[model samples]
Target: MSMKSTVPSAQPDQFVHDHLPPPEQWPELRFDRPELEMPAQVNAVQALFQRAQQAGHAGRPLLRSDERTLSYAQAQSEVNRIANVLTVDLGLVPGNRVLLRGGNSVAMALAWLATVQAGLVAVATMPLLRAKELAAIIAKAQPAAALCDVKLQDELKAALAADAATAGLKLLVFNTGGAEVPHSLEKMAARQCEHSTPCPTAATDIALLAFTSGTTGTPKAAVHTHRDVLAACETWPRHVLRATPDDIVMGSPPLAFTFGLGGLLVFPMWAGASVYFPSIPYTPEAMVQLIGRVGATICYTAPTFYRQMAAFAQQHGIGKLRISVSAGEGLPDATRQLWKQATGLEMLDGIGATEMFHIFISSPPESVRRGAIGRVVPGYEARVVGEDGQELPRGQVGKLAVIGPTGCKYLDEPRQTQYVKAGWNYPGDAFSQDADGYFFYQARTDDMIITAGYNVAGPEVEAALLQHPAVAECGVVGRPDDERGQVVLAYVVLKPGEAAGAPLVKALQDHVKQTLAPYKYPRDVVFVSQLPRTETGKLQRFALRQQAMQTPSRNPTT
Candidate 1:
């Protein structure tokens, strides 16, 4: 689509784009490091762990217990045993998709890797998923069977039986207690390992079926190929993170989301570093404790998580986390500053969508701008286009569009066109570029709350309120107002010792006013126990908006 503009001179020439990086800064592979390439064979499972057999058997991959450590040899043997049963006994085929439900554990990791190796698409999900949500996902993506931990299997079975759509699906329970199962994964593994050759699949073959967090609407599946998944392991650690093999990586995003998959699985494995996966409840305090216990060097999390971590770090001490990154949601400036002060590490803000599979724009540690989402990565193109489909000038806010090899194709959904335009994909985010070519996140174009004639992004007000010490968590949304068309309303969760009343409400309102333009301050404040979140830990602002609409008089009177 050709766009006309007052911005002809604004678009940098392709030559300018090419020369932006110094020749010396170009990626150089270490002689001893494995080559990073999109494999000629496209199978996702094979592309990632193709070397696991040799690596696993030669020396066991490191596994940490609650108090002890397990060797790499032990891990691979267990994973290989599971793979054999999945392929030989269950007749799990290359094309079949298997749903995996469990928290982070050695078994969950083995199940995911084995499913991929056996040529099955792994649909890993959060253990906290409610029955209703699980029913919707199961109906949308009918799996051949489910592999669940025994503890959670009863609830999963009940949820499956309660939903007519998932009745015929088979279930295989794996007791995480390390005991033998007669017909379970361990039992199947005791049989002969498969000697059959794997059917070669292309790099573009779908390896994973990851669902969106569904903070706003029904979750859509983001299909990722073996190549796309491997590309993240290859590109991100070098381009965005630059972590060494010795770095101990840890973070709090669930593995089901690509955010977690990249940090907790791919990045650490590619670097030959150890990744610590905490299976317990992840409060900010617990995260700080984990880092201290593990001597973690790289930490990945959302901006909200960063703020809480920073708060704990200020009161206590955050261990030596040399590299910290934030994505899954926008990083507020306050959180960024707090983390920097606490950890002495710049918090790299990344912007990625489920459709893209992983982060495409993020700050490299050395080149971070205080309030930007960094530059586009190599092999990707990003642009801001106006309503008329013309490219917008730097410093002008417009729809952010992107085109890359890993761009999205929704699973049989008509609204795919709504997010994909002329081969570019956009998840409805509005962004602006500065003259220096840094992208600044604005509101989602559809989510901009227009009050009178002013356009207010809900995130902007929420970020402002979060800067206050008394605020624990908050959501800002537009509530219908007869005279003003829409008024800003804030749902706030106060800190543990903070009181909830008109005084606190007024202080929050005044706090936002002091932090930002007065027009963006919340006119109404409702104290709540907690803000709603989707399974993937993203805030549910749309749900809060609905709640605000339902309770007309719930807004506190100042």
Candidate 2:
């Protein structure tokens, strides 16, 4: 199969300019032409919600939960029910921040759509984020209200109550299974008249405020407008995924992650396609079963998940898989080979960020390069630059910077200046582009370990290890893993009486595994007296890297 471009490929000079304008002063670049065919619709939420309503009136659109399926009309009526409560009951305004804490379920989708359709900002967060992390995010976003799953309601209440800065944030739980929680969405919507007035919003208005980890200490909110969402839904589908209305897209990543949100929800709704959202967290075997049961044609997930799916499919064949897309982290060469061997489908590698709102560079089904992240999308621009900000020649690895319709707009955070500079956004990644225009991911400019498709900050893991009862101090770095590409490695200075041995190493590993995602657990743990540091007290991470290299591989056989 071959992919033919309708337009001439853009040149590297197209990405560089003598002067770059700030957001307000961006005077329509020469590239902004009618040729671009940007979607007339504004935000993804507004457009999709409106379509869902239209589908309901036509008696065609249907949404299914594990419990039941609702027609388009039924789902629209439910959105109205919740929107009315937010407007009339809670007195939330258009720009009010409403933090959504949940997973990839129909109820979560409904809540997100309802919040945006009501003209409020929806900040969706991962369910697995710890209390401290959530509190840090809450403090920054300063939500007027929080819509959380009942399962996490008690923990959230405790976390917020313990934090003095979150005193004014209100809580509303989803209470899925009729949990013993007050002020559930179910209870509130039932009390309402089952209809709420629609609050119209402009496409330029802020509809989504998604929180993503920053190079700095805490996570920062990336504010995106209705325009950004629609742009992502349209461009990504047309150029990369190339999904049709007949395609049933399925994946393992949670909706909180941008990859899942765009591919799973917006893409389907935009094309009038059917989507299947699993009620439970995705296991490889569970995903195989779902795909076979739903007859899903297109699947969107990370390279790690795809590899696991390949392993699962080998044992129990995936009947109707047409295309599988991989993103969220670098796609290793081995994973790509294994996936192709097992499924006979090329894993479309893409490199995206919360900053760009969705994928900017991805391999179209026909033009996939097995080990590369692929060329820039039709409507975006990308370049590799040196430290002094000069464009690096093709084939030379350098800092990867991006500028496109969907760029970063940090919400009230000064770090915005650090990320978005001179009209180009750098998400702290190192990459290179070949003469043929294929992009290859190198590593994070920061010391973040992308293991099993999760960004694990080396410092964050080091902080977690320091809390262990037997550990006096620790330094964490990522070591290369054959499967994960990188695994967290910890060098610890055990507390005086704690001897260095297998039991102590095992205990430290167990402690970190319990503290964070088990995948981020330190595979190599070395007990030491002290870590080498400079006069200013920066732990010499390069030295730790050498120590990690001397340590044997801890990756399990694939």
Among the numbered candidates, top TM-score falls to: 1
- Worst 10-residue lDDT window for candidate 1 reads 2-11
Q: In model 1, what are the clashing residue pairs, if there are any?
A: 42-202, 42-203, 44-226, 60-72, 60-73, 61-72
Off by over 4 Å in 2: 1-43, 51-62, 164-168, 179-181, 193-195, 213-217, 447-558
Global lDDT of each candidate: 0.71, 0.71
**Candidate 1 per-residue C-alpha lDDT over 244-303 given as tens digits, one digit per residue, 9 for 90 to 100:** 656777787877887887777766665556667675777899888888887888888887
- lDDT (Cα) of model 1: 0.71
lDDT of 2 by residue, 271-367 (tens): 6666677777788889888888878888887654665577788878888989888877666666677788887877777878887788989887679
* Candidate 1 Cα errors over 4 Å, as ranges: 1-37, 50-63, 67-74, 163-168, 179-182, 192-198, 553-558
